[model samples]
Target: MSAWEQFITYVSQNGFYIWTEFYRHFLMAAYGVLFASIISIPIGILIARYGKLSGFVMTLGSIIQTIPVLGFMAITMVVMGLGTTTVVVTVFFYSLLPIIQNTYVGIIGVDRTIKEAAYASGMTQFQLLLKVELPLAVSVIMAGIRTALVVGIGVVAIGTFVGAGGLGAIIVRGTNATDGTAIILAGAVPTALMAIVADLIMGKIERMLNPVSN
Candidate 1:
């Protein structure tokens, strides 16, 4: 086939995969972030609230990071068996460190003077947290979340190795078929698009939710 005809043929054949799996991969990445956030945010808040726990939290997250992804997945599969649960949980755990670290840093980085002023103004602890501390810390927390999301997107794409299908299925197919460009585009394009869109959306949300200071 001529190059133009080959291009047309590839587009016709593969466009469905792109459209169908793009959001699937996006959701997989999102699932990783959501599950990780559920576990990490509360713990990070507690760690920041108590100096004693900060060391413990950091140590644990760091230790988890040291474990290789393939090893962790194999262990999880052996213990829990195959399928979505194992893949999701593995991706979730992989995503936790960034969220927890970022949250702790963000909360701790709040200006002490602002905190004091809020307290002196008769604002309750809850109010101070809601109106002052969280708003200021949002940027940092979002940065952490952004990092976790990017990492999770990359990792979860490999979950096809465990029977969970996403865009990774396309990648695996291309690899086995020896179609180099197909695998690269199939995997890289959707992932890159997801990361860009997610970061942009989160950036807007952070700006909107965070209070502006003069």
Candidate 2:
């Protein structure tokens, strides 16, 4: 059989297992990015509110981004032990830079005219941010989230190394087997599809939220 045929056979034979890993992988990535967003968005807003902190915050995010994924996982695994949690933590840190950067850019990108008008209309600082700035900036913030999620999906694949039960484990299994090209592809194809689907869905949402699009 051709490589493609073999890949199809492998996928068909292990559909349930593949799907289980896919679900696990998706959860690990999603949870990581979700947690990161909860924290990073607020941090992004604070730094935007106080410009003095932007540079420092950006620099800190950059430093975290520089950490080797495997090394980070190893460190976390030692502390947390082998599990999905370790992978989620790694994905969370990896997700921080894009979300925070986009959020900061989005908030500051709100128009000066609008801000003044909001202030003139008796909107308090909090109200202005809530009512005007955030609405306008939402698309950009979503763009950051989209980027983080796409990256997080890839990061979660490495979780298999820590026994996190992601598609990466499937790929690894193939690698450990003889004549495992199809097996490797069984995992690779789904990972690619997940990233592509996530990007398309989130990209659509980001565009739809843009006031420019509306």
lDDT of 1 by residue, 36-128 (tens): 898888888788889799888888888988988777878888876876666777878888889999889888889899989999999998898
> Candidate 2 lDDT, tens digit per residue, 138-198?
9999999999999999999999899998999999999999989999999999999999999
Off by over 4 Å in 2: none
TM-score on alpha carbons, each prediction: 0.87, 0.99
Question: How many clashes would you count in candidate 1?
Answer: 0
